[model samples]
Target: MAKNLIQVIIAGGRVVGQAFTRALKQEYEASQRAAQRAGGGNQGRKSAANDTFTGMSLQEAKEILNVSDITDAEAIQKSYDHLFGVNEKSKGGSFYLQSKVVRAKERLDIELQSHSKQKRTDQPPDT
Candidate 1:
C-alpha cells in the first residue's frame, strides 16, 4: 500500500538523519581534541586562557563585549552585564547568546589579569 511505502520512506529518512548527526558530532569532538593537543606545552595556559570556551579569539571577545580599552575594567563589566541581561534565556532570549556573553567576559578578565601581571613584572624594583 502507499501508506506502508510512506512509512518505510520516513523510517529510512530518520535513519539517515541520525547517522549524519552522529558523524557530525564525532567529527566536532575529534577536532576539539586535536586542538587541545596542539595547544599543549609552555604557552598552553596563556593561549588557552586567551581563547573563549567556544574557540573565539581575544579580539573577537573584545568586539562582542564592545570593549576598546582592555584596561577599562568598569566599562568592560558594564557592557558585559548589559549584554548578559539582554540575552537572558528567561527573557525570551537565546541560551547560546547568553553563553557567548559569559565566555567573552571570562576571556576579557583573563586578559586584564595577564596585562596587570605583565605590568608588574616589567616595572623596576622599588627602592
Candidate 2:
C-alpha cells in the first residue's frame, strides 16, 4: 500500500512539473513571436527613441536648421532663433511648429556633443 502511494505522489509531481514547463515554453515562444513581429528584440527600444522626437535624426535636425554646415554654431543658432521666433505661440505662430524647431535644435546639440566626445576619445593624447 505504501509503495502505491509513493508512486502516486511521484506521478503527481511529474504532472505538475510538466504543466509548469509547458506554460513557460508557451510564454517564451509568444515573446519570440512578438519580437520577430517587431523586427527584433531591440525594436521596441528603438521605437521608444524614435517616439521621443518624432523619429528625427541628426541629418534631419541639420536640415531643419537650414545650416549648410552643422559645425557652424553661429549659423545654426541664427537659424534656430529665426525659426523659433517665427513659431512663437504668443505671436499667432503655431505652437506645434515651434516645438518641432525646439526638438530639432535640442537634437542637434545632443548630436554635436556626442560627436565631439567621440572625436576626443578617438584622438591620441598630447605628449
Candidate 3:
C-alpha cells in the first residue's frame, strides 16, 4: 500500500510540473504573437507619425528660435547654442530642446544639399 501511495504522488507531481511548463509556454507564445502583430501591423503608414520627435514641427522650431527663416546655418547654430545654454542652466526644461536643435540642423543641412544638387543638375552637361 505504501509503495502504491508513493507511485501515485510521484505521478501527480510529474503531471503538475508538465502542466505548469505548458502554461508558461502558452503565455510565451501569446506574447510573441502580440509583439509580431504590433511590429507588422502598419507598413504603408509613416512610422514617425507616432514617434516622440514628431510632436515638434519645423515651424514650431523656427518660432521658438525667433527666426523668420531657417535657411541661414549661422542663425540656426546660434539659436541651437542659445537654447542648449539655457537648458544647461535650467533643471525644469525638457531635453526635447536638444532633439529640436538636432532636427533643425538636419533640416537646414538637407535643404542646402538639395539646393546645391539642383544647381549642379541644372548646369549644362559636359561637352
Candidate 4:
C-alpha cells in the first residue's frame, strides 16, 4: 500500500446526517398532509372541511396555543383546554375556529412526543 495514495479522507458523516434530517422532515410533512386529506372528508361543508385538518407547522401550533416553551406540557395543556372550550360550537363559536384549536393541540402533542423520544434515545444504556 502506498503511504500517500489517498491525499484526503472525506468525512461525509455530517452530510449524511443533514440528508437524513431533511428526509425525516419531508416524511413528517407528508404524513401531516395525508392526515389532513383523510380528515377533510366532509362534502357538504366545503369551507369547514377545507379549513379543518390544514397543514400546521410547529411554529404555527405554538402561536395558536400561545405556548412559549415547547417542553412545558402542563402549560400547553392548559392553553389548549382553554382555547378548546372557548371555541366550542355549542358556545356560539365558529366551527372553523374549533377545528383550528384541535389541530393546534394535536400538532403540539406530536412535538412533545418527538421530544420525549429524542430524550430517551439520548440516554446511555444501563450496564
- Estimated TM-score per prediction? 0.60, 0.55, 0.42, 0.57
Task: State the TM-score for model 1.
Answer: 0.60
Best candidate, TM-score-wise? 1
- lDDT by residue (1-127, candidate 4, tens digit) is 3544443222366677889999999987765665455444442233232334446766678899999898999999999889888988899887898788888888777667767887999999999
lDDT of 2 by residue, 1-127 (tens): 9999999999999999999999999988876664555356675434334434455755577778887676677888999999999989889999988887988888777656655777899999999
Model 4 segments more than 4 A misplaced: 1-54
lDDT of 1 by residue, 6-117 (tens): 9999999999999999999998776566547537564444655456354777777889999999899999999998999999888999999989898888888877887899
User: What's the candidate order when arranged by decreasing lDDT?
Assistant: 1, 2, 4, 3
lDDT of 3: 0.62
Candidate 4: residue 2 lDDT (0-100): 50
Candidate lDDT scores, in order, read: 0.82, 0.75, 0.62, 0.73
Measured with C-alpha atoms, the lDDT of residue 18 in candidate 4 is 86
